[model samples]
Target: MSDARLANARWPDVKAALESGKPIVAILPCGATEAHGPHLPLGTDVIISESIAAFALPKLEERGIHVLVLPSLAYAPAEYAAGFAGTISISMDAALALVLDIARSLKKQGFAMLALVNSHFDPANVAVLRDASETIVREIGLKVAFPDFTRRKLAEKLTDEFKSGACHAGQFEGSLVLASRPELVDDDARLQLPPNSNSLVAAFAKGAKTFEEAGGPQAYFGTPAGASAEEGVASLDCMSDMIVQAIAAQLEP
Candidate 1:
């Protein structure tokens, strides 16, 4: 295969893949244009989601699944980070519509399934994905596979920091970015930051409306200073497996 990225592939290649007699899967990496603390770049979610797709490509291909990675959906409902600058939060309705439209387009082209590799876990954003996935399967009749890591079964497979529910720009996410896009991380800022133990999950349960209300004044939770590239690579591997397994299950006869 040339490249699994749809943006880089010509139309002829896409057409050929659809005609190939093998299951054709389209991957949409869903992320957000929001703050991720001082050290990590705003596009951290995009980077991680895309990285998961990259890691899963070979595994997916090994199973005779033809894959095409759609250009990442970088904008999402990031209401919690709205207080921070550069955090573009879209409405849940808008996000849902966009995802449905993308799925509709792929369905018309004879795609077997659409796999959503999402790294942004904002509550509203997660809702949008859940709703969109259901709508895609119910209305469009397109097979949709989404590994919602927030669920206990999936969350338990991730890092301890992620399970702590305090992992925003903390060790869990920071480590993923470090492993994939190390150049984007501010080494000085990362090392100078103190640990934040505030659990966003706990705060949300208490009806906290924003990062500030959640006790993340710096828009961070958990221990960022403790993040390591080694842990990041490991996290990606685990996440990639999740994506592959979810898609594989949906493709089952």
Candidate 2:
């Protein structure tokens, strides 16, 4: 099909692509409008997810899979960062319903697989995705894959500081944005900021309700000062691989 995104495509082109009789896959970039500390833009997760989808588009096509990159789903259950000026979180039920409805719509249009390329890391948001997508896997015939970076295999591929529990707008994410959207970063502010290594993961397990309770007063963790463009590109590759592996499994089966 055309290089245009599904959201921008004419219905005729979409139908032609669907009727091509190939393994049709729809890439949904799930992200959120939330706080990413002081140096990064609010669209960090959405930008990262969309960037990964763009990078993986040709790769998936080369592997003989017909692909459509959907517009980023820009809101999720981000209770962890609520009250942060720009953070907009949906209720858990609403988030799940949105994903389910969209997936059902794609399946109706003939997509065989729906891969969720999500980058929003709030435990609450991830939970909604895991629960909703899991139900779809069991109840629907359409294949659904969400490459949760928190999962062991994908987590291992990320940085040391990321594994430490505080990765919000830190090196891991900063490096990614630096690579894909340099204009969105404030280099001076990032380099001067000290690392906040508080483990939000630990805090969540302890029933922490907000960023401050999790020990991140400025809405961040890890070292944004150390982020580099090179690291960002490498991280992008890892995210792209997650999508490929998910689709490969269904093809093999």
Candidate 3:
């Protein structure tokens, strides 16, 4: 793997990368430190976001774009999972401040654009991120590329389960963990859970506040038993492509 991660790169390497005279885009992977059912780890979203950014790096390099992958942001508003143990649900305002502060600092650090690769699907989290992105772009003119998967078009590219509404900690999310950190997955328990066909989007539409009320009794939905490493790889490919495309549109336009 190339040393594209900003956290591990030396100051000289980072300075050189930033001054490469290309369209430099810093990758900020956002995830939530929340419970992901009985089988998956609490850092499932973090692992997935980092993995997607890693997968997208070499491709961006090939396109003559300098990439800087910041360490995954692990705190976000996950009010939907607040009732579950191990879920750290930050307030919406706090999340917005964190994102805005990061962007402000990055803008001053010589990077031209900030691409947020977020895998957490909680509405409150996404809302804060989207709002923050808009605010940053408006205030400092720093470009932000946020791939909104909640949209039907983008979600359709991932999988049937994703489009069917049982995405949280289900096959869609589990497959990502399986591909990136298989050792973290409890294969036995994951393979035993039945399919939970709850519609998280619809639940949110009805003003449901928690996953428990959204029909995710075990803090998960979707068909975990059917998750495959192959599916995870495919989904990551789609997600990375979306991020790359968003960046290209911003830089090229």
Candidate 4:
């Protein structure tokens, strides 16, 4: 795997790679600049995405998958996290537009495939990524893949305990960051917010109105104290392996 990530590499290098007829896979680390409790960095999504991509790239390259990592899409749809101090969210429309445009650009550049390595678990953002990826695949003739990170399969393989509910800056995410970048996690500042008492499961659940109205006064969902860097590393290793395999399967002749 080349140390030359696309965000740092010159245009000519990217052009040459595209022109070389090699199997190219662009890893777009879709993330958000939002509050992840006091314990975690505001750019938790960005760090997680970058770490996952870094871990996955070499394994992917070994299988002849030329990986180019794009810089993290730092702003995403995070209405739920809006009440938090550091949260910076985009409108759903803007988020979708940005992802779609990036996908279209990658298609035009002649990359063989594009994979969205999303870290933020915002429902609206997930829907947009799914819609945009599908649209690009049909309209622009490019292959796009989005893998859910909070699911049972990933959780079971990555950690010993199964997740309890809809994940936010909870155990799953906090643990991931702890493992990958322990220096960024502040264990003492971790908070364990009460669960949503609303009938709805999350902020985007059917009857959601406002973040406060849906998920209580605070933006967070679960306990962040249980997070450990060891758990985070394990989760990343599991997900990276899964992503690498998915990319390989897609590239199979």
lDDT by residue for model 1 (1-253), tens: 5888999999998998899888899999999999999899999999999999999998888887778999999999998999999999999989999999999999999999999999999999998999999989999999999999999999999999999999899999989999999999998999999999899999999999999999999889999999999999999999999999999999998
Cα deviation of 114, candidate 1, in Å: 0.5
Question: Tens digit of lDDT per residue, candidate 3, span 1-253?
Answer: 2587888888887777677776678899999999898999999999999999988887787787777898889999998898989999999999999889989998898888999999998988889988998999999789999988877778878798888877889999999999999999999999999988888888889888999998998999888999999999999998999988888788886
The better candidate by lDDT, 1 or 3, is: 1
All models: lDDT? 0.93, 0.86, 0.89, 0.74
- For candidate 4, write residues 50-146 as lDDT tens digits: 8888889778767767889888899988877788888898998898788778888888889888888887877777777878878878887888766
Model 4, global lDDT? 0.74
- TM-score against truth, every candidate: 0.99, 0.96, 0.97, 0.87
Identify the superior model by TM-score, candidate 1 or candidate 3.
1
How much is 217 displaced in model 4, in angstroms? 3.9
* Model 4 alpha-carbon drift over 4 Å, by segment: 150-162, 191-206, 209-211, 214-216
Which regions of candidate 3 fall more than 4 Å away from where they truly are?
Answer: none
What alpha-carbon RMSD in Å does predicted model 2 have with respect to the real structure?
A: 1.2
Worst 10 residues of 1 by lDDT: 58-67
